[model samples]
Target: MNCKSLQPAAKKCVNEDCELHEKGFAKYFCNICNLFDDRPRPIFHCPYCNTCRMGLGLGIDFRHCMRCNACVSLADKDHRCIPQKLQGSCPICHDTLFNSTEPLKGLRCGHVMHLSCYNQYCRGQNYTCPLCMRCMEDMSDYFSLLDQAVRMQAMPAAYQNTICNIYCQDCEKTGECRYHFVGLKCTQCASYNTREMGRYEQLAAFPN
Candidate 1:
């Protein structure tokens, strides 16, 4: 496409009514209006089409939702708290969310919390998830996963071995143990602490 030929996807000849609206290929300026939809409406409840394409314009950069498994098309510091359909008290304060301040913040574990509660939960030591315990660096990743975790997953099998199983120092139970080298998920014999990890030691396999 050429830079001289572009328009709103909603108006162009592109597949969805606007192929000419190919981003960057054209000015993306409305001919008569001579301005972009600065608000870039998500087209939710479009009376013209009588359809709601809420997620159509969303991109990877869209902020992750502080509560549910969705994304917010805004930045963390600028996130707007809105009524969410998901049900749960603020994870940090355990306060009812029906009328309380919305938890417009998120944890890597997907737990939702109000910004104030999140800070207080960490006791000013440095706020993070009570469950994941992942330290918060910048406000940006407050709702996203750490990059390193994903990088490790890309390693080969040699990097996928379980070194040992963790156990309670005194309980002598494998329930609390984690096989870091092998894997994280515990078999039916036990439940790995998804929210928490425990100490471990090498042990022989049990007889089937």
Candidate 2:
């Protein structure tokens, strides 16, 4: 067969001897970069955010890419589709319930769906949990916000742009992980700096 006619085989990226996992989009990139490839060649990290994610071996029953059109990034409520600012459509299913000004719940996973629509979806799939399908986890956290007459602590508008955050030196998770802003500190002092963007982090820890 001609070189162009032959399709590349699906090879597992790890040593699990399984076929579910495969190389991410790029094949020339390394799994990690820590004094590994400094010779002057360019490195490809990830598609969305390049970080030289190489040598990051895969494991059985694990996935790195799901092509999820998560609801967290949208055209409303910082594109997060908060129930109060849902103004877009679901990229995955293209639901039209997002274009509303009233309280409309969009999934935290970037799926803009009506609260009722999601409930109906769950009801049909033998009540399968919406996220990850690993059985529903306790979700009283997000729902409690919907309860009226709930006197929640108020965040000053000054902190609307604030991004309270932390950077764990261990695991380098704080800097590497996206949610590191939860416990971030003041760059000028030892006090907890609620200033994300070092200027606008509006949320405090939800439960504590």
Top candidate on TM-score is 1
lDDT per residue (tens digit) for residues 1-208 in model 1:
3344444543344444444445422333344433334354432222222223333444433534545434555555544344352356776667764334243556544456676887676676654456444434343352233233433555354433334344421122444332343234333323223333444333554321
**Residue 88 in model 2: lDDT:** 49
Query: What TM-score would candidate 1 get against the native?
Result: 0.30
Residue 206 lDDT, candidate 2, scale 0-100: 34
The most accurate candidate by lDDT is 1
> Once superposed on the true structure, which residue ranges of model 2 sit more than 4 Å away at CA?
1-88, 91-93, 101-103, 108-110, 126-208
**Model 2 lDDT, residue 47, Cα:** 34
Please write out the lDDT profile of model 2 over residues 1-208, one tens digit for every residue.
Answer: 1123333333223433333245322334344432234344333333332233322332322123324322232233423223323334633255654333223444433334555666666667532224333223233343344222123434455543444344422112232111232334323322221223323343554321
The list of candidate 1 runs beyond 4 A from truth reads 1-71, 74-85, 98-103, 124-128, 131-164, 167-208
TM-scores of the candidates are 0.30, 0.20
**What does the lDDT read for residue 172 in candidate 1?**
26
Looking at model 2, residue 145 earns an lDDT score of 43
